[model samples]
Target: MLKNIAELNVIVDKYVHWFNHERISLKTKGLSPIAYREQVLGN
Candidate 1:
């Protein structure tokens, strides 16, 4: 169970990275979600 939990955490992290950094969003002129939020919100 512990090992499975660790693996799941890693997979979740990878998906999060892909969603935030790799996928381009249309709302911010085709920038990744992370970049768009940073630009609009001021990181």
Candidate 2:
């Protein structure tokens, strides 16, 4: 149901952001992948 390439890109970007920086994982001890990575690197 995406209307155009731009809309699809926007949806992909949002999903990527959520997957990497927003959604928490129990295996990561309740941290998103990006957060876990930054924590591990002491950033």
Candidate 3:
């Protein structure tokens, strides 16, 4: 378990980055959530 608030924040940040930038789904055409958002929004 994380022993301090800083450690917990670090872990949360890691998971958030992974979820938005590394994780992918078939519905997204194999793109990560961030990538899919950028493509759809034309950013």
lDDT of each: 0.89, 0.96, 0.96
lDDT of 1 by residue, 1-43 (tens): 4478889999899999999999997877999988888988989
What would the TM-scores of all predictions be? Answer: 0.68, 0.92, 0.88
- Poorest lDDT segment (10 consecutive residues) of candidate 3: 1-10
Quality of model 2 by C-alpha lDDT: 0.96
The candidate with the higher lDDT, 1 or 2, is 2
Models ranked on TM-score: 2, 3, 1
Q: Once superposed on the true structure, which residue ranges of model 3 sit more than 4 Å away at CA?
A: none
Clashing pairs in 3: none
Q: Any residue pairs clashing in model 2, and if so which?
A: none
lDDT-best of 1 and 3: 3
Better of 2 and 3 by TM-score: 2
Q: Flag regions of model 2 displaced more than 4 Å.
A: none
| TM-score between candidate 1 and the true structure | 0.68
lDDT of 3: 0.96
| Residue lDDT tens for model 3, 1-43 | 7699999999999999999999998999999999999999999
- lDDT, candidate 1, at 16: 93
Q: Compared with the true structure, what per-residue lDDT tens digits does model 2 show for residues 1-43?
A: 9899999999999999999999999999999999999999999
